[model samples]
Target: MSIRAAYIEKMKLQLDELNTTMDELQSKAGTTKIELQEKYLKEMASLREQSQGALDRLDELKTSGEDSWKSMVMETEKVRDAFVKSFHYFKSQL
Candidate 1:
């Protein structure tokens, strides 16, 4: 695969794994106290939005032509990095 294709595949896989981890975290939150649960749910919603934003960026990169892929890659990385950093922070609280 070309560099663009390889990058897209890697991002897609990583995002899929992140989604799964989110689901597991949500499930585990069920046992938390009511007050903490509310906070956890709100954070999960924000994380989901960030995850969606990353997916949107990845889609934009995927649809871009070879010429535009260079630029799209940077935007994609920013979105993905933001989502990942947020996820790790949230996970650390758990």
Candidate 2:
């Protein structure tokens, strides 16, 4: 596969993983106390927003030309990393 193709595939996998994590978190939140559940839901909403940002970056990367692909990749990676960090921190709180 071309570099761009491989990068896109990798991002798709990351998104799939994020979805799974979100689902698991949602399931846990359903069983928590109402007060904590409220917090969890709010954080989940933020996570979803971050996830959407990553998806948007991926879409942008898809249309970027070879000359600009590397920089786009870097930007997308930053989004992915931030999302991953937030996910881990949220998980730790549970």
Candidate 3:
């Protein structure tokens, strides 16, 4: 397969893994005190938005041509990085 196809596949898997991590974190968050749970929920909402943005970028990347796919890859990486960073920060708070 072409490098572009390979890169897209890797990103899709990364996003899937990120979703699973979020689910696990949410499960842990559920047992926190009500006050902290509210805060974690707000942060999780932001993480969800970032995850959705990454998914949206992935969809665009899938449809892009060879010439445009490189740029899409860069853009998608930015979104994915932000999501991962946010998740790490949230996890640290727990």
Candidate 4:
């Protein structure tokens, strides 16, 4: 499958794992002491970091694709101009 599809699948899996972890954490929070609660918060922060990293990567990839498309359009315009100029020159020679 395409790279995009694969990336989406991976993100879905990560989301599922994060949800499960959060649920388990909430259940365990009932019995957790103050220190353990603090630790759980820290762990939750870490999980958030992971999700943020994935989102950042996705944004980067999207930006990269946009840049590539812009470059292609610029190059295509240049080629089209050159072709038009060449055609005009040939017509003028007739």
Candidate 5:
């Protein structure tokens, strides 16, 4: 497979993992105190937005030609890293 294809596959896997983590987080939130639940919900909503942005970036990368794919990869990485960090922070709070 070409480098672009491999990169796209890796990104898809990352996104899947992030989604799973998010689901777990949501499940844990159910047991949180009612007052805190509102805060957690807002944070989770932001994380979901970040995840969607990464997916959108991946879609762009898939259609981009060789020269432009690299840039998209960089932007996607930023979004992915931010989401991961936010997930960890939320988990820590619980």
Candidate 6:
């Protein structure tokens, strides 16, 4: 695959990992007992850290290229904006 394709694939993998971490944190928030809540809180914090690390890696990859990386950055920005719009729309409905 081309360098741009490789970068995009890697980014998708990182985003998937971050999504999993978010799911875990959301699941933990639904628990009722105090002990379970604490457990979830700890797990959520750990997952949050992991997700942040993945995001940092993504940023590093995104900026590391000289030519094709520009396209990747532009496309990624467009997708990010779409995601934000979708999120905002959903939030408004809630």
Best by TM-score: 1
In model 2, where do residues sit more than 4 Å from their true spots? none
Put the candidates in lDDT order, highest first: 1, 2, 3, 5, 6, 4
lDDT of 3 at 46: 91
How do the residues 1-94 of candidate 5 rate in per-residue lDDT, one tens digit apiece? 9888998899899889989988987998889899999999999999899889888888988898878877878888898888888878877877
Model 4 bad stretches (over 4 Å): 66-94
The lDDT, on a scale of 0 to 1, for candidate 5 is 0.86
* Tens-digit lDDT track of model 2 for 1-93: 986799899997988798798988798887988999999999999999998998999899999999999989999999999998998898889
Using lDDT, give the best candidate's number: 1
lDDT of 6 by residue, 30-69 (tens): 6657876676567556555645555655575556667666
Give every collision pair in model 1: none
Clashing pairs in 2: none
Q: What is the TM-score (0 to 1) of candidate 3? A: 0.93
Candidate 5 error regions (>4 Å) = none
TM-score of each: 0.97, 0.94, 0.93, 0.47, 0.90, 0.50
* Candidate 6 clash pair list: none
Candidate 3 residue spans exceeding 4 A from truth: none
RMSD of 6: 10.2
Residue 2 of model 6: what lDDT? 83
> By TM-score, highest first, what's the ranking?
1, 2, 3, 5, 6, 4
Candidate 5, residue 18: Cα displacement in angstroms equals 1.3
Against the reference, the lDDT scores of all candidates come to 0.94, 0.90, 0.89, 0.53, 0.86, 0.58
Per-model root-mean-square deviation over C-alphas: 0.7, 0.9, 1.0, 23.2, 1.2, 10.2
Candidate 2, which ten residues in sequence have the lowest lDDT sum?
21-30
lDDT of 3 at 37: 92
Candidate 2, residue 55: Cα displacement in angstroms equals: 0.6
Q: Give the 10-residue window scoring lowest on summed lDDT in candidate 3.
A: 85-94
